[model samples]
Target: MTLVFSTCCFSPFPPLHPGRLTVLPQEALVQIGGSIQLNCSLDCPDGTPQWKGLDTNLGNIISTPTYSLLLITNATVAMEGTKFCVGNCQGKSHQGSTNLQVYSLPDTLQLETQPKELVAGQPAHLHCSISKVYPPGSLTLSWYRGDQRLESPDAEEVADDEELFSYDSELEVPGEKVTEGMEFRCEVELLLPPSDRSFHRATAVTVSTKGKSWRSELGILARWVCNFSCQSHFPMSLAILVCQG
Candidate 1:
């Protein structure tokens, strides 16, 4: 019995584990006016988390373990870059980052042009074509006369496929209006949700009557040619000649 009395001691301690930080919108390419959200979460039970955008050098730490950083109401090209989130647990630090890409909207947008040079007091049609849009979303089309916006009764929107969206407008120029050398514009806008930013594309054509007579003559000649031409040939091949003429 005396030999068996050896003392046994035990020590109790919790296992150590590493902390983790996560960011959302992991891979994104957004328009200048669009926005995004970065959510930061930590695995550690006892830690304060902070979020920072490395490009802007802006950040904040909150008492709550989880934190969210908003891209705000609108974003610009200057805001493009990597954003970081950090979690500190008892002096131990863990960090994560997400890359952001911002693109510039087109300055002019248009698909088809009838009577390329618009004439006053005449009906004109402009087709707006928006193509190669990333992150498929809803779109809006608008027409402008100089700086003033125009209302169209025959404006129609059509999505040709997943990568293309278009709108056509039949505009009636006021009979008494004189729009010499004035600019007529077409604008296309793409909308994204959870963000205040909109992608924009626009195209402008100069108004002139100098070429109207020539354009009409060309149209008459085109009609005559088409009337006699064989329909068996590819429509695109003939279209190219008409467009070039």
Candidate 2:
């Protein structure tokens, strides 16, 4: 009996498996002085994952068997960029990336009225200013009156620099439209990528008609009180008393 010689070829290392790679927060909006964490995960247990496009010295990184974490503290404009995660599974390379948008938003909005005295039938101006905002190009200014949008002015050009900047916007209102106890609002919007954030400041002005006497002003005040009383559903007698007084 003749036995045919058979030979089998085998390798000591197990076959490599291809697995899915995922990165969380594909797009992030990190406010100035805030922090963010990004995660990179791999399904293939044999894969080695690493971070790219990140300064290891600036941020902290945590590595585990199946995932990696990147922590950014005190995010600022310098940290705005794309970050990548590269993984090798079964000798094949895979990459996942996330976009970081670091922005500075004004903590407060200031609204000021030109000319201490607001008079009816004359043009008046409202100035809105927001300070310490980064990426001023993405900023927008809007004027509103009681939920009514009066106008949206284009953002003025500002010098691009590492330091934060300030912006000013002005609105001119016809005196005829300015009434006693009129509320004007200035809204600031940061049109950042992924989503937009906004803040607003409002001021109420007491306007007097041109050439109006003190008695007329007092009457206007009384009428305002009466209107408030009526709107509050106070007793009709109280409303009448407010106007009479």
Question: What are the per-residue Cα lDDT tens digits for candidate 2 across 24-58?
Answer: 88777688889999999887886767788677665
Once all C-alphas are superposed, what RMSD does model 2 give against the true structure?
9.8
**Residue 156 of candidate 1: its Cα lDDT?**
60
lDDT of 1 by residue, 165-192 (tens): 3455555455354366777777777665
Worst 10 residues of 2 by lDDT: 197-206
Score candidate 1 by lDDT. Answer: 0.62
Off by over 4 Å in 2: 1-17, 117-122, 151-153, 160-163, 194-245
The TM-score leader among the candidates is 2
